[model samples]
Target chain A: MKYGIVVFPSKTLQDLANSYRKRYDPHYALIPPHLTLQEAFETDIDADKLTNIISEIAKKYEPFQLEVHKVSSFQPINNTIYFKVKMNDVLQNLHEDFQQQLPCEESKHPFVPHVTIAQKLSNDEHSDVYGSLRMLGVEHSEVVDRFHLVYQLENGSWTVYETFRLGKD
Target chain B: MKYGIVVFPSKTLQDLANSYRKRYDPHYALIPPHLTLQEAFETDIDADKLTNIISEIAKKYEPFQLEVHKVSSFQPINNTIYFKVKMNDVLQNLHEDFQQQLPCEESKHPFVPHVTIAQKLSNDEHSDVYGSLRMLGVEHSEVVDRFHLVYQLENGSWTVYETFRLGKD
Candidate 1:
């Protein structure tokens, strides 16, 4: 359990989470899409523990672009559709803000932003998501200047933990 | 559909969409989050139609804060999230742009500007999403400039369609 901004968009991400809720837990409400200013740490980690981490990371960053996306699935096999932001330097640096606050030696994969489309699904559901996506192919790209903090509950759905926008991307 | 522009900070949105591809639909991915000049029409559409609608709406806007949130969701229902530009004169004007474009016979809904996060969730799958949301609770807000245009495909994901940034907001 680490602390960082989990970027998701407005109603779209919430709706995706809702899809999971409708299917599985029945309690998976979502926050908003955003980036983090903290780094990876364990669960329930307090913000007090992160002050130093955030400062250290911020000290190094001047605000860079947090790439907007990377299409992926909740699970490869079950493959529910989902799109998320790229964890570029700006995003990583923003996460570093929280990561630096954590105590030394935390074991966790680094954070990358993502908008979950559904809970884990098997073959048939996977193809349905893919089918929908196949039609919406990429036409262009844009910029993101904000970061958000999010948390995952036992149900495995993510909620808005926090959000911070940079002065510049 | 009524149209409006949801402005993202910068490249952060672009990267998010890029990352979304890694796990979701790798083929045609989402374009970056941006200001949209058109709405989700009630019927087929194109840029000419959108521009005509937007040009008029643009005049009504006096410029205001389009607070960028982390993400908003559409799912189990839509399985998606997006950044909501805090409703303002700008958003209203954008929406007004499209409203004017609609044929007198067309029905319209309130227009809003925000980015998409996820989509395509069947009902039975996301029943629990309600309670799942409180977890995300917002943490940050950002001020942004510019409106981006993006479109979602039959697949139900979005890509940057175009961008129109206006005076400070």
Candidate 2:
């Protein structure tokens, strides 16, 4: 199964991100608002093994606050627009911890932890959306306590298969 | 008190890093063979508070292997030659986790996660050391099970103020 890991933002941030996604992202219906820790990877590793790994890692981290303030884009490379996450130590460590157990192929660029706002836009469409997006001036913050292990269904929508709480006794 | 956090490498790796340091680094006597997670910072936060925070974070992670290989330099910017520490999720997360609690202002760049082999060299000295050092090409790997929260003494050397074991129940 194809699996990914992510933590959701606060309700207000979720609403804000969802609005942008609904307007610009074609895959908005397939996934909800989240900061992805692990991108989708195909793995047949036993569920027990996955649980053991995540449980051990999650226990090491206390919940931390994650702030989202900047609207940015993967320009020239892709038409995708995203919110630049202000990575404090906790958020950065959590993502790194996940990568240790599941070593995905390293991409050309270092990982830019972000929440996608829009994607698959033409030049004109991107310009139009970006211009409108200027007034929003992204800003949202929330305490991150839990992350989910999710699997994609045949229809493309993702389902949360397991939820792990950070530093929960 | 001024404090720093670090993980010591295996004895073999320690010897290798020290050999390079003794030849090229001026601060070799002040510090020892270690991969710094956080540079020194002054904090009035109680020792108990510091210990509690670290203990909480340390419990969540299991020991993992760290590999230090590749001789590289932070040239033009810092003129420092170092061994690149290959950060898997464990090491990366550990560093990030520490940053959340003890944010240091002096680190102007994002953490590159390296162990300094040589520093504070004259232009001529750097060229000479860099040339001779090329043949020694670094390669060391070992399990990292514990880390220390240490403090500097009046004479400039660091002493272990506290030790936190990884994955301790």
Candidate 3:
């Protein structure tokens, strides 16, 4: 089965991300707005065993603050527009932990935690949206206490198979 | 350090358990009413590694129903009066998983998942309370989705070090 790990932002953040995604993101309907923890990957491993490993990973860390400070875009590399989440040690450790432990390939991209609001745009449209969004900016922050292991359905929409809560009991 | 794994029942159940515990359970104040998954055991293992292992375990299963249906006592076995929790494959599997994975001594007693309402009673007192409570017959059920890794504090109260949510993602 194909699976991925992600942290869905708060509803407020999701609504804001969706506001931009409705017009700009083609993938808006395919998956909820989220910060990709581990990119989607193929795995033939036993579902029970995979769930066990992820559960253990979730128990070690406390909830951490996530800050989305500004609108940003991967203009030069790609036309991906995103809410740039500020990096911190806790978030970095979580990403690395998932990378090191999960039975998946290393991500081709560097660990940049983001909520992509727009992607796959032509240069002119990218510039138009990115320019205005950057000017408007954005500032949202919330405590992230849980993450999900999601699977793609036959229909191509992603559905959560499990949710792991973070921190001490 | 010494650690244990347990599931704290809902407040409705806890409140019910505490009612009997106030009069019968000597260890009532030391910890909240809980179903012990793994008994307290000393460990020299690195905390982070232990946490990682536990997180993996938590992800493997979904929330399961717990039905506490009657007051029972371990007579001739030690006079441990408890709210007998009916056994199910999910709960049994959870207990066995912890036993097989965690660095702890093998339990001397067979696994009988329960919430102790009272313990350490005299032969006569145990029979008296057990008889009355059995006649009263408590019934409560809830879906338990998470468990805790807890440690004992210097004050003798147990506190949660981490909480692991069960199921995928």
The most accurate candidate by lDDT is 3
For candidate 3, report its TM-score. Answer: 0.52
Native-referenced TM-scores of chain A, all candidate models: 0.55, 0.92, 0.96
> What's the lDDT for residue B112 in model 1?
50
Off by over 4 Å in 1: A1-4, A8-28, A33-45, A63-70, A74-80, A95-113, A138-142, A150-163, A167-169, B1-169
Best candidate, DockQ: 1
lDDT by residue for model 3 over B13-78, one digit each (tens)? 776787888799887656767899999988988655777988888888899999988888878789
lDDT of 2: 0.73
Model 1: how far residue B112 lies from native, Å: 29
| Per-residue alpha-carbon lDDT of candidate 1 for residues B56-118, written as tens digits (9 for 90 to 100) | 555445546546554455443355444455677656655555556654233343455654433
Instruction: Give one digit per residue, the lDDT tens place, for model 2 in A54-100.
Output: 87888889988787788888888888888888877766676677777
Local accuracy of candidate 2 as per-residue lDDT tens digits, B24-131: 877665555678888888887755578788888889899987877788888778779888888788777777788886645556677787888899888888877877
> Where does model 3 exceed 4 Å of error?
A1-169
iRMS, model 3 (angstroms): 17.2
Go through the candidates in order and give each one's DockQ: 0.03, 0.01, 0.02
What ranking of all candidate models by TM-score puts the best one first?
Answer: 3, 2, 1
Task: Say what the RMSD of model 1 is.
Answer: 13.8
CAPRI-style grade of the A/B interface in model 1:
incorrect
Among these predictions, the greatest TM-score belongs to 3
